[model samples]
Each structure stands twice: as C-alpha cells, then as structure tokens.
Target: MDISQESGLVWTEVDLSGVFDLDVDESLELESVGDGRVLAVSASPDVVNNVLVTDNGVDWAALPIPNGFSPWSVDITGERWLILGRDPTKEAPGTQILFSDDRGSNWTELAVELGPFDGTAWIGNAIVAGRLIVAAVQSDTWQPQLDEALDDDMAYEPSEKHVHLFLSDGGPAELVAEFQGWYTGGHGASDGFHLIISGPAAEDYLLHSPDGRQWSSTIVDVHVTDSARNELWTADPTDGRFKLERFEGVFGSDQVLTLPDGIGWMPDLAVGPAGVAAVGGPASPNDELGGDFTLPDISIEKNGYELRYNQPEGGITLWDLNEDSAVYVFDAETLQSEGEFQGVSEVEDASGSNVVFHDPETGAELVAFSGEELAAAVTEEVSAAYSEYDPDEFIIGWSTDGTDWEWQTPQEAFGLPESTPDDNSFTQVQVAVGHDFVIAMVQTYEFLGSDFGEDAPIGVGDSQSDSTSAYLTTTTSPSPPRWFVARVE
Candidate 1:
C-alpha cells in the first residue's frame, strides 16, 4: 500500500481486498490489542457466522461463534475481547456479552440482563478503566420501519429513560450505574482512564471513572477525548461563537483559552492531547452510505464535531491548542481555486495533531500548523476523477481543524487497491479515524468469488432469429452478507 506523511501523522493502507473467502455482509469493527495484534468482529445476526482474528492483514484465522446470539458490537478491554450481541428472543428482549481471551478461539458468556429492556436495545460497548470494564446499554425510541405502516398516534419520540451501565471481569456481568436518560456517547477508556459517558440530560450526569471500583461524579458535557482528561466548550448566548476551556480533571483546575468564535459547540465537542483544532467546525457533513445529516436548525455542538458551513470568504478561523501556540487561517481558497470544491466530504481528526479531508474533486489533503516552525501539508491531484460508484478508491485528505479540506494522495500509493483493474461499483462502505489508525468497514451485497460454480445458467435459443449471435451471462446469487475490516496505519 502507498504511504503518505506530514508531521507526526503517517497514512498507510492495509489490503483486505479479497482477504475473506466469504462476502462480508454484516457490521464490522476492528480493535487493536496492542503488540500489533488486531481483532476483527463480523457482528452478524446468524449464529453460523465465524469470528475472525488477525495478527497482520496478510494472514487471518476464524473462530467459532460459540452460540446462537447475533453480535451487535465488539470492544477490547485490557487483554480480553468483549463481544456483545442479542439473543434470539424478540419479545422479552435479551442481550449476550462474551469475553474472549485466546484471540476469540473460546468465549465466556455473561448471564446478566437489564431485565425488560424495551424500545431500542444495544449492548456490549465496553471500556476498560482500571479493574472496571463498563459496558453501556443504550436504547432509543422505537420508530418502526417507514415502509411498515404505523398507528396514527404512534409515538416517534425515544422512550429511553436511562442508560444501563454494567461491570464485568471476564465472568458474570454486574449491574453498575444506570445513568438517567439514554447513553448518547461513550469513549472507550480514553487515556486508559476515565470512561466518559454522556446523554443522561443537560444538568445530565457526566458519569466518569478514573478507577473502576471507585468513581466520581461530575457535570461538564463536552466531547469525549482520551488525549485530554476533560475539555469545556462554552459559547456566548448572544453570539454563536465558542471557545475551548480545557483542564486536568479531578483537581477541577482548567485554562480558559479565549478563542475567536463563529461555530457553536455540538454537545459532543471533544479535544485530544495537543488540542489544536480547526475549532470552527467542518463545512460539509456525511453519514453512513445512504445517510445524510438531519439537523440544520439544531447545532453542531449537539451532533459532535461535524462542521456545517464554511465562511463565504473561503476560509475559517483556526487555532493551535499546544504549549507554544500560533494561529493561522484554515484555508480552502487554494483548493477552491482548483474547482467548485463541492464542500468538504470526508473528514478525519486523526490522532490530535492533524485533520484529514477528502473531496471527490479535491482528493485527500493533510494540514497541520503547530507554529510557523512546525507547519506541514500534503495534497493529492485535485481532479473530479472517478465519480464512478466506488468506495474503496476513496481519497485520503486532512485538515488541522475539521473545516477546510486539503487533499492528499490515495491508498493505491500504499498498495490497497481492491483488485488489479480499478476500484468502482461496490458502494456500501464507511471509514472513521481513530487514535493511531483509520478503521474502514465494507458491507458486501453480491457474493465475492467465494462460492464458485454454484449458479446454473439457462441458455435460450431463438428459433426464428436471424443468423447472428448468442450471449453468455453470469449472475451472483445473494448469500447471507457479512462485513470485513481494514486498519490503516
């Protein structure tokens, strides 16, 4: 795979093109268990699915599902792999949380249930803080499928009254703090300390734990970051602008850095270590494969870090959150100078040092300016090239904050093309940035070359047809879909 770099960040790709013999058709998540060992979960509904483990993307092995429960998500706590899923019961509502120590070869299931979990149910989002492994059981209002007819007075409002928290030690699950309201956010032990959970309410509780056994309660709501203990985002009621006030938690001491504001804080504004951010917000927004962001009248701070608009001036104000700070404008004018610059498409607030942006025309770019002495950037050729329905060929881009996008080269430079020919056609895929890696998941619909020679072809002979030709065609039988994972270093 091609490797790209600027400052402390390095963009690399791992080839998972045809790694799995099965067409991955479910939700996929990747967890790094240190020592370069990576665990991948193909969170499928059918119990016949296999659990995959890999040391490097080059080689992979399969582990049995152990039970009939369908996995919802996976998390890594210390040396254990926690796999959370649901039981077959739809009426009573059940949850299954499993712990894997031997790279998922074997599993120990937790017998704990929050009892009559109604409405929407999700489990197994675990974070390890000290001896405590807190898993969030979040439920949202049940809105039946739009295609499914509903009663006239059917409620679309979420019935989520509380977020159930649990503590486990690779054994029986114990119920912990069930915070008020649904759990809107959970940071998986950011900093290996402080498992931050939000969404209880506004004066809502910010349930945090430094040590698993003993916990402290606090009431400041911002984005969850492992880089910093806690960050405070405040805005003037009269003006929409906001500034970040960060402090070392426990002591309740913080530094108030007055910032020029234009962007409002999305309830989930998080800052990492080396807190320099574009700070304003991103100009473009995208979610899921067929997903579009809903809130416009709502605010950015309400939805976390996604920026909604860029100034007509073609740039947004910026700041560096490091010790020796210098500020610069997050410029997209040069990129806009390339074309219409159809807004910033995909954004990665990678690590905490640099932000990456991707536009179909602008490609991928990385920009980081800690000080004039420490400014770096890398951009790809700006062309509205392959608008073809391709997800694998996505451009890797960057930004200091999340706003202005700068294009960088692509994953092909690092040997990550799907096949030899070209990457297009397959569409369902999504990628997000993590502490030191890029996690991408692709949902497979049509079967790969997995079940070869399975289809029976029908040849139709046109009797009265002219002296001309016949056509031979092939078809892909839809199989139970699963998903696969790739971690870009």
Candidate 2:
C-alpha cells in the first residue's frame, strides 16, 4: 500500500471499500475514465462466467454480459460501456461488441461482424474524444496447431496480419471507420493517443489519432527478424532500454518514458487518470527460450504510479511501482499458480482512488488504473502462511516469516486477550511502518454491566453505561534486536 516516489518522498493513500465486491480477481484490468470514475474490469476465463468492476478501488459491481469471448476490453463514457471481444478457441465470427447503459448490471448487443475466419486478435483503444471512439484491432489467419506441432515452421500457419483502426458513434458500440498494418498492441498515452503496432518484418510503428478516426502512422525504424517475436507489448518508455521511440502529438509524446534493457519483457498496458502505464515482465532466459510457458510482464496505470508485476516460469510475482521504492515481490507459484491471486476478497468495505500519473520530467499528464485497498494486513514472505479475521469482534491478523511476529497485537500475537470483567472493547485499528518504527493506532470502548437480579431489579429498563477511548502502539517486525536498516550516525 505504501510505495516511495521521487521528490524525496510522495505518498498517495487510498480508501478501497467503495467500489468493489469480494469476488473480484487478484489482478487488475485497467480502465480510464474521462467523465466518470475509473473502473478496473476483471474477468477470469478459468472461474467466473461474468466480468466485474472496481470503481476507483471501492465499489465492486458486475459488468453486464457482453457475450463475445472470455477476454474483453472496456471503455466508459459517463455511464456507457464500449466492450470488445475475440475468442481464441472459437472462430472470429463470434467476436462481437456489447454495450450497457446501467453499468454492467444490464447490456445490449452491438452489430459486429463475427467471422468464420480466425483473424481478430488483440484490440486496443487509441483515442476517445468529442463523442468519437477510435480503436485498433489486429487480425491474422492461423490454422490450428496440430498435436504434433513442433518445428518452428510447423508450429504456425504463415498468414498476413493487418491492424485496423475502428471508429464508433460513441453510442452503444458501433463501428464507424477502419485503417488497415500499423499491428498495434495496447495503445500508449504518449503524444496524443498513440496506438503502437509491432510491424511485420520491420521496425515497430506508432499511429497517432487525435479524434479517434484519422491517424498518421510512423515506422519506428527498430528492426527485428520476423521469426524473433514471441509477443509484443508497450513498455514504460522511461526505462531507456526497450526501443520505445518518441512521436510528437501522441499521448505522453511530449516526453519519453524509456525501458531499460534486461529489466522488462512483455509489457501489459494499463491506463487510468495518471497517464499510460505499461508494466513489463522481467528479462529472463526463459523469456528468450521461446516456449508456451513464457510469463509476460504485467503493467497497469493509476494516479501517481505505474504498477508492474513480473511472472517468470519458476518464480513468484514481483511488483515494481515506478519511482516508488516499495517493490512487492511475492512467490508467483503461490499467488498466481496456486490461484491465491485469483481469489479476490469478499470484503465490501474497500475503496478505490483515481490515480493521475504525471511525467516527472516533462509534466505530461496521463491516467492510471483504479484499485481497491482492503483494511486487512496483506503480508508476503518466502514461506507458507495464513491469516485470521473475526468479523463479529472486528479483529484481524496474519503470519508468514516466523512464530514470534512483532507485527501483531497481544490479542493477535497471543490469541484474543482475556475478556475484562468490566466489559472493555477495542475498535478502529490501524498499523503502519515508519523510520525504525511499527505503529498501531486504535480506539477503545468500555461498558459497565447493570446488576443482575431475578426479582430485585430496581427498574424494568436497566442498561450498561458506556465510555470511549483511542491510542497507538509501536514495535519491530522481527523484534527489537533485528534492525531493518542500521544508521551510520
């Protein structure tokens, strides 16, 4: 929840109970909001039959059925939905667009050509302006890979691919215009709204569309052999290594966010209020090995931060919030493989915030993704762990690293404290880590029970008296002897 940033220190705290339901996914699918709250759309091809949303981070609501495929893209205007789809297993004719007026609670189908040709692949939003919705969709015809598919030449059926820009009427999902190769991945907010596509047998290209209809495409001149591509993504341009070029008049185009070599892999794109945040996977040997198990890097945008998660073949998921010092690296085998990350909490009291990421150097603006931060202490370590919560008593705790954790309360460190005879209760708890400090903030309540009697009651309506209080506690994570960071002074 706490990530360090530039300017020495920058903090953005969000209350995440307002827009989410407990059945959401562990990962976030980013959505940008122009006239309303940002949404994080979640769809699990393995579990849930429906898609849901976490608005800004708090409220959780199910998206109305868009009946196209397992994976889909969402674009919201005020309360309208622009949903897209393409099924990997089914023929392309099944890919259709759906719309909704009442959030995702209900929906209406839009006319889209579902084809017998297996062409449509990745779809991206290029621009949203003045009631015009511009997007890029890729199409390729590949014959099904047989069970004996092994050799590189035998693995794929070589076919021509085309990337097209589709224009819509900005009402219910309707296609108004189309531009065919500029194979754009998820578009970035650089320059205006720049839609980037990895070119065939040449350098990747960036297509700029302001009104979401007319666009100018430019080849980036970064070349790669036609056979080298296992996947393509839009990376965080500031990292400096990935050849993400700068194009004028595109979103974030005024400034460049570079991708350092050996740092990022397949960049999953996310956009919120901040700007375009592309999170990439780790640069690993397995990534270069060219297999079906290649774990792609994941990135999402939100206000003030570009969040990324890396999933390697045999590792945990690691999240690095750009310029934010807290890099949460977790056991991916547990979080993702074991399906822990897929199990979103059912706690309804969570909230979300709209994140606006600004290019620190150029001050260029872009939106990031929305997320939910629950009131539970989410701990991650290199071992097996468990957490317990008492809804009736409003208490919670967890453990991972060891038996004697300095992170819990006496009630938590041990079990629940012995109930006081006078009836004392604790409530409103919070924990935080500061310079050499672990702080616990809380409030208390005390009540005096009335005298019990079968026939000697002074009055028919006897009650207990009540009092309230508040306080804080500080401790060490590994107990006092273990200093997290020793000071030289």
Candidate 3:
C-alpha cells in the first residue's frame, strides 16, 4: 500500500473488454457507458500515434490517423458514431475533435483549435447535448502566464473563467459558448438546449440555449472543486463534520440529514445503479451531535447502496462499489464481508487502501479505491528503431546497487520511457518519474544492417547492425524522487 510513484502507473484491469493482446505499455483510455459497452481507446497500443478501439470488449480496428497525445476523450452520439479528439496536453499543444461514423474503422476531422488548457483544465467531464459539445475550458489569457513572472509582492490578476462551447451547427471547433471563470463543472441537458456547469460558482453563471449565440445565468454558491472526481464528496473544512443534503426543487430548501455525531467524512462519494456512498475520517463524540462538522457534506442516491455519514468519533470509515448496480463506493477502511458491522477501520494506522475491482475477462483494469498515492508519470525512455515491430517487453525495476533488478511497468515505476524511431536505430528515448513509482525504459536494437546488407555479413558487421548494441540506449541516475500522495482515506 506504500507504493512509490514508480509503482502507481502500473494500473491493471480484469478484462480487455475486446481485443485482449498487447504489451502493457500500450496506454489505454476508458469511458464507462453504463449498460452500453465501455469504450477503450489506445494510441500506440503497438506504437504511439497508432489508434485502436474496442466495443463490447471485442474487435479492435485502427484509426486512419495515429492517435496523438491525449487522443482518447470520446463523446458517443445517440447514434453509434462517437466524437474522438486529441485532448489537450502540456507536452502536446493544440486540441482537435474527430467524428467517427463507423464504429472506429474511419474518422473525419471535425475541428481543431489552439488551447490554453494546462494541468488545471477540466476536459474529462465533457458532455454532449443535442448537437453541441461542451468542454470545461480554462481562462484563455496571457494573465496566467504573466502571473508566473510577476513578483510575489504584486497583486494577483483577476481569474478568467469560461466554458468553450462547440456546436455541430457548422463544423467542430466552432466557438459556441465562452462563459467566464475557471471550469467549475456542471451536468444537465436536453436537445441542443441544455443546462450545464460544475462547482458552486458555475451555478451562478447559467448558459441555456439551443444555439451558440444565446446564454443565461442563475445563483451560485461555495465551489466544491475536488481533483478526485470519483471522490467528489465534501465536508466542512472548518470542523470536519457532515450532513447529507438533497438538492430539492429549491436550492436552499435542501433535505439535510444530521449524521450520528462521532463519525468523520470520507473524501470520496459515489452514486450509481447500486446506491449512494460517502467516506470520511474517524468518529468523535461531537460527530453524533453535529453542527459545523455537519454543514458541508456529500449525499449519494444509488439503486443498491445508499449511505449517509458524519465524521466518526474513532476508526476509519468505509464503503464499496456494487458491481451488479455499477455504483462505486470506497472500500471500507477495514475490509468488509456480508453482515452487520461495527466500529471503524484504523485510518492513520492503515498503510493504505488496497481494494480494487474489474471485469473478469480483460484483466486490463486494477482499480484501487484507497491505497498509497496514485502518481502521474512522464515517459522517460523511448525508441522507434523497429516501427513495424514493437518490443514485446519493457521492464522497470529497482536495486540498491542500481545494477540489480525487479521487473515492473512504466505505470508501476516512477519514471516512464518514451521512444521515437528513426530509419534503423531508435532516434530518442525519454524517462519520466511520477509520484508513487519509479520507472526505466529500454529499446530493442535495430537488426537491419547499414549498406542495405543482410545480417552482420562477416565480423565487424555493417553500421546498422553495429548500431544495435545489446544494451540500454540510456540509463537514468537515481536521485531524490518526486511524489505528492494525497491522503483521501
């Protein structure tokens, strides 16, 4: 549970859902469509740039253009066709959207545009209503960039907030809505006419229109901005108490539940087919009484698992996802079995949460509800020597001596490897270390010979074959690692 940044990237799933073969380095993108088949997109499943898709977890076809950086966020139209794109990335500039009429056999360029998106941009929760595509975009101004250069003593620049709205009116990329403030977040729509926003701030500036030209607004409140979307639960930051509130026909007239004062609130709250669940810290005598400790809280309403909570007086609290109902719940602080339970899991005493679930077939997913830090990594090494044949294995390991080894994956290790291929030898390799794991990358040597000759000919061999040294193209020196693991449990 005390995973290093290197260990965090090595994610696993039970079923491929469709095409099951491929090296683990093949980065995958997943979209859960409820009863509908989950969508999995992979760029470089064999090599970066190449795109592949699987439906019903079966047949995988390639995309005409190789999938580029962040080419995985897809919006499925009511029709079978889906809207795919080159999601914004710090490494890769610009943003683009592609339309796939056929499952994924072919695609048409919908639109492309320059993006000011960065680590703070919220593009993941994009929603589609009628013919419009709504993306939670960040402020598009030089102020943010300039802010970094300004002296700390200088006053902070005003924050520019807006939602980039694209409509099918003509082509993709067509600017529709340009509201203000950082992308808070919201979800609700009907026809092209829809009501959407996030965070309590988004509620104030309302934009409802069937066409791009029109917009509107409503009241706003305290913003609930949580990076862990799944753990989108809230509690009073001041007293650490909880109260479940249901958004009634009227905003302030919410149905509030004062929890049994003594229990703490978990960072995550999940609601799905199964039921609603929320987690929090330990319980205290005050938890039963409730007050500020109960002010800001999360409420979930699911079919199977319904739960409400208040910070507890003692012990780690828990919850879980119901596979049958598809509701996601954080694993109990202490593992649970079918039956009545009491007390709580030892929060601080616990090393980390280690509860994960997945479809039985693919084994591609290994979701851990609460565990050590889940680190985001950068590609460390890469090679493009054999574009036709991707190396079957790229192992990451650790050693006190730096020479010994323990095989691991880029997702599992701190620094990951990124490669590019030249005519024969790989042109470049880069390694990136994330929060929880360390990583290393190795590329396969070029087998082709220089003079267009076959094999090594005789002794010294040709230039191409000579270039193929049976050793690592690059090795990284160990250094102080970088990891910031948030304690949500």
Q: How does each model score on TM-score? A: 0.44, 0.38, 0.39
Q: Report the lDDT of model 3 for residue 207.
A: 47
Q: Report the number of clashing residue pairs per model.
A: 44, 77, 106
Tens-digit lDDT track for model 1 on 160-235?
5556777776566677666556453444343333434455355534555554444565665553321121234222
Q: Could you arrange the candidates by lDDT from highest to lowest?
A: 1, 2, 3
True-vs-predicted CA distance for residue 403, candidate 1, Å: 14
Q: How would you encode candidate 2's per-residue C-alpha lDDT over 1-489 as one tens digit per residue?
A: 011121111122333423333232122233433222334444444434345543333334665554435544655543455566544555543545555667667755554332422654555433443344555556676665777676665666677676656666544443434444445344333333566666676567766766565667676644222212333334344433332332322122112323223222212222222233222223333333443353334444344444444434333322335655433344545554543332122222235553334443555543333333211211221011212212113212211111111122235322335544343333333222222222222223222233222232110000011010111111101111100111110
User: Which of 2 and 3 is the better model by lDDT?
Assistant: 2
**Each candidate's lDDT (Cα)?**
0.39, 0.37, 0.34
Q: Runs in model 2 with CA error above 4 Å?
A: 1-38, 45-71, 77-80, 85-93, 100-106, 114-128, 135-137, 142-158, 170-182, 186-193, 210-213, 221-255, 259-489
Q: Which one wins on TM-score?
A: 1
Q: lDDT per residue, candidate 3, 75-97, as tens digits?
A: 44233344534544435544455
TM-score of model 3 relative to the true fold?
0.39
CA shift of 249, model 1, Å: 23
